[model samples]
Target: MEEERLVTQVTPKSEDFSRWYLDLIRRTELADYAPMKGMMVIRPYGYAIWENIQRLLDERIKASGHVNAYFPLFIPEGFLRKEMEHLQGFAPEVAWVTQGGADELEERLAVRPTSEAIIGFMYSKWVKSWRDLPVLINQWANVVRWEKVTRPFLRTTEFLWQEGHTVHETYDEAQAETLRILDMYRQFVETELAIPVLYGRKTEQEKFAGALATYAIEALMSDGKALQMGTSHNLGQHFARVFNIRFEDHNQSLQYAWQTSWGVSTRLIGALVMAHGDDSGLVFPPAVAPFQVVIIPISIGNWKENTLPRAVELRSRLERVGIRVFLDDRSEYTPGWKFSEWEMRGVPLRLEIGPRDVKNNQAVAVRRDNKEKLIVSLDGVEAKIKGILDGIQASLFDKALAFQKENTCQVSSYQEFKSVIENKRGFVQAFWCGSEECEARIKEETMATIRVIPLEEEKNQKGKCIFCQKEAGTLAVFARSY
Candidate 1:
């Protein structure tokens, strides 16, 4: 109760976006700074959101023929060195352990910045024949990266994520799997999280360390900044050759296994916070909300005997119908206080059952998104609750889609690009000559980078390069990102 009272108000988002974001996280009890500089402790409420996300996404992954597995967190220096490009890409961010029980070890073990090196070693052993062709496996685990600047979920030293690694016999099979996972990620993020995303291929400068190509889903935050939601990479035969993952093919010839790795991390939790949250606090989509409905019994006359019982019964009924509900029966907080508390916590639906309402067999249902209230009859309440939850999920996605549409624009020249990026922050679409030099120049002059290059069809539509004025071959979305 004291903690609830302590959360007064967040800084208005329009006044200060960063402060508003940090303030909402603290007041809403999502996560907090850890004793370590580049780490955070995700609180129960925040972890619950992640748990729901994991449950939903894992179902999709498993259904797509990927099995969950665990790999070692530490990779030997020798193992990482085998794949020099991958090692070099992650060298700066990799954490290392050199001592064991106060004794210096012979070889330093690197904390996984990503699990490709170690997973490749194991795949080399497990995949000796073509029969083990498409080995689709996913790991739900935490990884360590020594980040200089850290936010709670967005850029932590250690974070929870699901990384999928697969091995296929042919390049086409691997490519298909990579694109399929990319589409899968888009669907899961857009449907379950209720956050609209623009997805496509990453530029050469932006692709994963050793991947042949990388694809990602990028979402526009409320502040008009881009947040990469997920990525799927096609590793090709690079890792297979590096790790000696040779297999006998159908033609009885030894061939390297084509590979892929893809993942989405708890950074998504930060995206959800930035995308849909308002100055009030978090505004979680119904599908991923910890408790979709919170039942607050009005603490009026004889509430304990009348309203409380009714509220408890309603909670039971809702739970039976597979709805997550929380009945706040604590006598210390007033109904108004509970409403404010739950609103800040971002429960999609709030039900108020007062003694008078209980007598009339009705409850006041409040929506977190629009603050709309509906007098709902207790009879057949499950159907109404389900409908409202569905509506909230769709409405949140629609609102985010509208925001993205309003913020995005096409620039004909670098001047317009710089102006749009500086004066107004959002996505700026422009034709690129597919040159890393031009990409670096834009990032240097204006702090915006190429976020995504639209897939083949759209990218192939040519125009003059926005930066160089040369005939360009690709359409790319550029933005300042988190």
Candidate 2:
């Protein structure tokens, strides 16, 4: 395993962050290249992390009165065309299926880039009265898009995600639902994943297809790039009208229902990796780490035989308290090698027990985030592990928040915006005229687009477009994103 020891082969963050990120993802055994050009295989370690994320998020969704359900993977050709804007937005990247069982099919089917169309059809049938309003359903599934460029979990040809669709009777209720889901996503990212996010609404041009308004939670990566972690859209009556989903009101009138759709994908795993990972490798928060604690027995001479028993006892103690703990008792690898391997996997806390420490009635606990080591007494080790995990979660969030604040900048001039984007590479807070033409021009010129318009637009700042200086309509966050 001499080759595995050569982990310090890349340039540091200050030198080349992109290369450093690619190296960390590959070295940590999180994912690997597959035979498909734009697709990658998520290894067990990476998938385990995703499973933790999914479990927590799924709990939140179910608690919010949403029911889990399954949707078809393929949508008929005409279904997508039900809404013109939706087809226009997704047409460029959709992969179509035109054959079945060695025979040519007359009509093509789209391997759902998103399930809005297919779900809309179901809503039309199930919703006959206002009492049937607010059909909240969520699906845990995989989606496909033929992307021209791909990056692991960030942008892949095929990815795993949960898509939620809901119908409401009133526009206000649907809008409220959209924001509620966005807040749920924001809280989950900040509290569970320990990544701070900026909650906001996307400009009309950046909003989701067929949505009246789109709400999103954006997080700043360590490299100064903004990542849209998740989004919720107020679809309004657009989809309801197209699908002819009319509900009979109490007043003996029929009206179109309001709708909402929201989702968070595996791409969030990529955000966690880039936002918190360091030179050592992944730095996972305790709340989402698959193994929060790993025990490595430090054996020396005759201590090898005697120390193994103490390590087992400590592992049992931790496991009893519901800590996801692992014992590294493999004799083939040295303690130092085991330490590095577990560190690379981002195990939150590691307990190293040796004959001397066991005799002293203590064990050395090391943190993965800061690499701080402390001798913790075995008497209340379970309580101590819980406290340490809490501290790790808070520290990770604080560190990420500080990075975001430092990288975020306010730009007034187009020249300043261009310079900051080219040099700094983070979120740029600027005023905009709220014109799609200006948005397109900025993207064409600097390759940066309006990521989101803040939900709480700064009062009294609505004055010229940041780029064109025409009248400033609203404040929008602009950035080059993944």
Clash number by candidate, in order: 0, 1
Cα lDDT of candidate 2 equals 0.89
Alpha-carbon RMSD to native, per candidate:
2.2, 2.2
**Candidate 1 steric clashes:** 0
Encode model 1's per-residue lDDT on 298-367: one tens digit a residue.
9998789877888989999999999999999999988888988898889999999997798899999999
Give stretches of model 2 more than 4 Å off.
Answer: 1-6, 9-11, 458-460
Backbone clashes counted, model 2? 1
How do all models score by TM-score? 0.98, 0.96
lDDT of each residue in 158-181, candidate 2, tens digit only: 999999999999999999999999
For model 1, where is the 10-residue window of minimal lDDT? 1-10
**Stretches > 4 Å off in candidate 1:** 1-7, 456-459
By lDDT, the best candidate is 1
